[model samples]
Target: MEALDTPVLDNHLHLDPRYGRGIDAVDDFRRLGGTHLLVVNKPSWHLDVEASEGGDFRAVFEETITTVEEASEALPGRAWPVLGVHPGLVSRLVDERDFSPAEARDLMQAGLDVAAEYVRAGDALALKSGRPHYDVPDAVWEASNDVMRHAFSLGAELDCAVQLHTEASDDLTAVAAWAEDAGMPRKKVVKHYAGGRLAGPTPSVMSEKDRLETAVERGEPFLMETDFVDDADRPGAVLGPKTVPRRVRWMLDEGWEDAVETAHVETPKDVYGIDTRATLSR
Candidate 1:
């Protein structure tokens, strides 16, 4: 595929230090024509049983901010941070780490509070939080949902966008309803790692064209993402960071430039309040 002439941002990706390949991954993505990325803090980097019990995430939050800063200095204009506690981690803390419901809630809330501070300080572009896997225990699922609701509330209060990492088969209508209850505008909700199966009023960063077409029919805004995990063991577990840009190049080759531009350019700027041209020129 030909290189894209227009800038493209991968809306969700993990480039934390624990990954070990963070910098290399960012470089690879940039070399492949990706212009910008929203670097999310991995759950393991923050949530722990002890921290959960105490409702403290000061250390983890500081590390996450440092990671974002390092990535920005390395790639400049191409890296931004998305902060929040992951629902999956909350479930893990309860189920595997033996954290109580109250402890888990405290941990989740603390993480959201810190995330709010980062967004308010203009250090983070959005909040990343959502429900865990579908097969988790009902109690654990509920706890995760509670944390997610809290995240939505915080995002609304801060006027920041939220990137949701939910189950593949989950109904987004329910999620959107939760966002509405939290006073978060549907437009500020983004379904991360979305494909062709789900549909809802909120925008999504998706990979499949069929899903993209379905979303467009509903007149909701959307973007595209590779969800690159940057894991050597899972090499391209979701898709390479370059996948979105390569797809854009192919779409351009097919004379679908307008549609491609809408997803890769227009929708991202509208939703995230980021200007790719402005970001890259900095």
Candidate 2:
């Protein structure tokens, strides 16, 4: 309906070593006139799988949380981390050494239990997803309900959002499916691109046209996963940084100015749990 400016939120960004070089490392995240940058509230959670298998789960969990708290305090406003048990965390629980499907199922169920209490109980939102490429077991799909409901409740109160990767580009589908079981709020639901989509295909690659059309038909708001890292070359391409802006413009060109709300780039209100927002207005 209305033409908006170039401001947009890069919904999915990772603070890996490549991006987190120094204090001013995040300066580039704001290059496109973004508003806020949401990051992992707890990065240790993402790495727990490796630690659990090689080191100690209990120690890893404790160390991860502590590090997250400390980092959140340091960053203050640049990083907004979504907390929850990742599927990668569960993959560690199985400890098949091979990371088999059946083992993934058992660990997936455990993660739901952990998520229900730790994450659902005001810890953080869990960002778990299963990929057919990974050949993951059905257990993960079955356990999503128990985990999502808890995560959503926490997110609702904290004024935060949780994203689920259930094999779709539209936020509504992922939100609806999660709501059916977890009762998550649609208002907080944001659409995102798949992390591995760049390696395999574009969001519009296979079910691309359909998902884009569905988002248009339902007036669904879309967000970008612009930090996707490609592995095709000696050094993969950053498909999102270049592709996301183009897609957003394309959607606007196709007449979705109002239907698809662009996520404004923003700074984290707080780093870990610090009061970075105190400086900014509500």
Best by TM-score: 1
lDDT of each: 0.72, 0.40
**Clashing pairs counted in every model:** 0, 18
Top-lDDT candidate index: 1
Clashing pairs in 1: none
Candidate 2 C-alpha lDDT tens digits along 1-282: 232354443455444432332223234333333333444323334443443232223333344344434434443233344434454444444444555545544444444344334444554433333332243456644444444455555445444555544444322454445543444455354333542222211121211344445545643234455543322221223433334444556767897666335223221111122233342222
TM of each candidate vs. truth:
0.87, 0.53
lDDT of residue 183 for candidate 1:
93
Query: Which lDDT tens digits does candidate 1 get at residues 1-282?
Result: 345578777778776456447677777776667777778776654324245432365566666678767766666356788887777776667777788866777778777887788799987889888887567767777778888888889888988889988888535888888888899887788888776345553455565556655545544456777777777677775777667666666666667667666776688777788877777753
Candidate 2 residue 280 Cα shift, in angstroms, is: 7.8
Least accurate 10 contiguous residues by lDDT in model 1: 46-55
